[model samples]
Target: MVELRETRIQTRQRVQPDDTNNYGSAHGGMVMLWMDEAAAMSAIRFTGEWCVTAHVDGIDFRAPVPSGDTLYLDAYVYDAGRTSCKVRLRAYHEDPKTGSRTETTDSTFVFVAVDDNREPMPVTTLECSSEESEQLRAEAFAAFEE
Candidate 1:
């Protein structure tokens, strides 16, 4: 049994000059790409199977990540169905010199577990350890229903 906390994932990448747009901010597409990858990893950790990006929504770009910042992505499986996992993702950018981080984006993604043939496969449920986690899990599920 995989605990919900076990599915949590965090990744960081330097925002290089090439990763930015003409405005010197990280490209929206680049951020989304990194979020997708991080979310898939969380889903895979939960299901122990290959996962593919199925859907993404509510991608709010709250702030812009400058070219010299370090982009940080955090993801976790908040809920799951028979074959799909719902992941919550958030992005932050840190000033390398100042070591201060600020949230830049947040979104939700659905990933479907897949077999070797890329066919949808069944997944196990996420287990929550503490009452706080259980409450959070319920809230996350409710948000997804809306």
Candidate 2:
């Protein structure tokens, strides 16, 4: 029963002379880095114990965000186990002037709580009380299947 909420992360990096590939877009690794950070934040909020990324189940680059575009990441924890939490992350490109948004990438990641020795630590049950929570739970399941 992880407590999940919409979390945001922003990073601005220009499509520098050296940052672009043949396509002149931000590298895939750069996008993934932001996604991981966003997911980690959600996981930490859900589990008080230190969390380590157990696995990144799936990362789909739905669109390419140009290097000059600002990347916005939204993440939330939707499910939890005794020691693991599932976080859903979405990356979008925002037009600074018009404030238009286009989703670029989305992924689901799992993190496990660990002690100082890096052993798995127990986590409390998640509490889902509202209709939104129920919808999130359903989405988490559908994402897991994908």
Best by lDDT: 1
Model 2: per-residue lDDT, tens digit, 1-146?
44444322344444444555568777888778767877887777778778899999767788877767677777777777788978877788777667688988767889999999999999767777777767876787786765
Top TM-score hit: 1
lDDT of 1 at 18: 94
- Local distance difference test values of all predictions, in order: 0.88, 0.74
Candidate 1, residues 54-130, lDDT tens digits: the string is 99988888889999889988888888889998998889988888878898876789999999999999999788997
TM-score of 1: 0.91
Q: After superposing candidate 1, which stretches have Cα over 4 Å from the reference?
A: 135-145
